[model samples]
Target chain A: MRKLTLPTVLLFIALALTTLSNAQDNIWTPETHMKVKRIGGTAISPDGEYVAYVVTSPVMEGEKSEYLSQIWVAAADGSFNLQYTRGEKSNNSPAFSPDGKQLAFISQRAEKPQVYMMRLMGGEPEHWVSPIPTSSL
Target chain B: MGWSYGGYMTSFVVTRTDRFRAASMGAGLPNLVSMVTTTDISDYLVAHMGGEFWDDYDTYEKHSAIYHFKNVVTPTQVIHGQNDVRVPFTQGQEFYEALKRKGVDTEMIVYPRTPHGPREPKFLMDVSERIAVWFEKYLEE
Candidate 1:
């Protein structure tokens, strides 16, 4: 090891201080928190070929911030991944049929959250079940 | 399966239908009456439940999944955080016990030091992998 010179030591200190200051400048903020995407509600295909899950992202509109959750499907072998749902409303609770050809989930597109079924081969999601009216509850 | 509201949906849907071969419920509320009293957000649950559970006992019972457990035939895997205050761990326990007693295949896993959901990356991955395995086991006919 070489003996450290005063000038070299001072140069190292300066670099360390600069890095610390830069880190402080990049401290976490509310905006930073909002940018994070969360994944949940995972379901596996019957054949274990694909996994369906929900990705929740924060949307900032004017001064209001809202979360938008959409279903996503990915191959279990990590071959391909794709978003299974879109639009402004939130969709969640993905479940696969025993046949592995269809996916069932809850969507908030209607007045209330309803169950939807979509084919794996491709096509639009079908609104399947609507909850009982609140009046009955 | 799902967490929080999604968990609630899983429990509720399983009671209404037997389409799914297997399901994993994460921090789900199966009993609205117990959930309203035990959850941290009692007011929110009460508002959604239509009123105080005591005031509308019939309505609460009718809406709760536990009341319709006899109709559930699908095997369910229940996962919950021991420290969860939002849905309460007892919800998962109750559902699991009910299914087990009914001879409907069921299992419950409790994670210590966790809240409404698993926050650690390992716990999250474990949940995903375990659920996948559960579906595979039951879906295989």
Candidate 2:
């Protein structure tokens, strides 16, 4: 066996710890560089068969950039997740109403964060709640 | 957690602060992942001794309720762990008091001798059940 120097042991330990942390963080943070990683919204479909969520991420451009978010949905079993939200703007927190026919979420499409709702399958956006404080004096 | 009000993905968080906060508050929100480490990460956070990610004003006070807690709405419940060093017990109290002042429906519970996220089985069951009940009561019409 060869003698191991103290520094060599320290270096080995550091490398081991670094590798361990990376492995752990990867598992904790699902996927890579998510458009939106934080909690935005969750909705169980009226039939309880589908779920939708809002995801946001920052996209860097040649100059100043802003947060971009969209709505993504998947089956209850985690299948067929697709981006349902449009526009390159920021959106988040996609939630299905208890009735399951309508979906609600927060968006910055108008340049400020506020909640909005849309049909589960298509067309026309309705403003639900404004982030503008109704009572914040 | 079942989605923090301030838009934090406590669901994705893996820290002691998140876990104990979940448990102590009786959150039924499932824990996807939580750190079970040798060093009490709570203490590390309490000491304010970790590398700061929320250093920039926007990040640190990302809607910080610190020192100013008056705009709380909705009936609220606050739960805390005595041994929680991550967010510290003080923050909970501040929140609790704020909700109380506004007279929002609220309740507070503190677990004794539990860290941020104790693996104690009973605590897990308690937290989950409580959260479900709370949602049913408040969110469900």
Candidate 3:
């Protein structure tokens, strides 16, 4: 509605350029990638009440970095979010049983990746099976 | 059922069981011996496979799908990236060749200059379509 003003236009252009330059400077970096929490696997409960997923975060392992993943459960309606598993090594590849009473996941705690099962109600995770090369072959 | 390691899993399961009618393997490490030498994660393979290929031939041979390709009957669609350094295109090439030679229904789709994961939209679409067609052709029967 106002008359053409060169100074006002130049000020707006300068502000836009500064915002663009700031965005360009915030490029993706290793630090940012490390901070990203990766969802390795996810499965919805049969009843559709909760969702099980694996959340992995990068951790400094001496000079190197490694992913430490654990299974987590979240309410379908976003009411609650809780960590379900713990300990060293990674616990990933979550799969909910058809009845939704059990959750199975793979872990490297036994040196080789093995399937472990847990009842959603409560209790310690039990090692269901270790289908390693030696056992399978 | 999987990609990469899952790709390897699909390949392995088909050999042991014919329950799966078809499979889509993406950037999979089929041959552990070649993988240890060719992949960007050579040290990881070497450590996990337990020593170098020369030092542990049994471990490499036992795990390598190339060694067991003769037993695989399920039709497989191997989707790979030409520039995949982690699991080289040669892995997919080898599996496709073996399956073809064995008279198994198989196909290989290599996305040009693509990395481990297909980045280009066109390549991704092509891969998904190819997989769908492969499954439709094999499973629908």
Number of the top-ranking candidate, with TM-score as the measure: 1
- Estimate, for each residue in A61-137, the C-alpha lDDT of model 1 and write its tens digit: 66434578999999999999999999989899999999999999988888877889999868999989767364643
Clashes of each: 0, 8, 0
The alpha-carbon interface RMSD of model 1 comes to: 10.9
- Candidate 2 iRMSD, 1 decimal: 15.8
Worst 10 residues of 3 chain A by lDDT: A58-67
Positional deviation of A73 in candidate 2, in angstroms?
1.4
Per-residue lDDT of B66-131 in model 3, one digit per residue for the tens?
A: 887778998888888999998898988888888899998888888887899876544544566677
Model 3 Cα lDDT, one tens digit per residue, A1-137? 99869999999999999999999888654445455677868899999999999997766656434558899999999999999988878888889888889999888888688899999867988999856563652
Question: What DockQ does every candidate get?
Answer: 0.02, 0.01, 0.02
**Residue pairs in steric clash, candidate 2?**
A35-A56, A35-A57, A36-A56, A40-A93, A41-A93, B20-B116, B28-B128, B75-B105
Cα lDDT, model 3, residue B63: 86
Error of 2 at A86 (Å): 2.0
lDDT by residue (A13-123, candidate 2, tens digit) is 999999999898776221243333454667678898898877756555554344566888778887677777878676776778787777787776785667788887776
What docking grade does candidate 1 earn?
incorrect
CA lDDT scores, all candidates in order: 0.87, 0.54, 0.82
Candidate 1 structure, TM-score to reference: 0.51
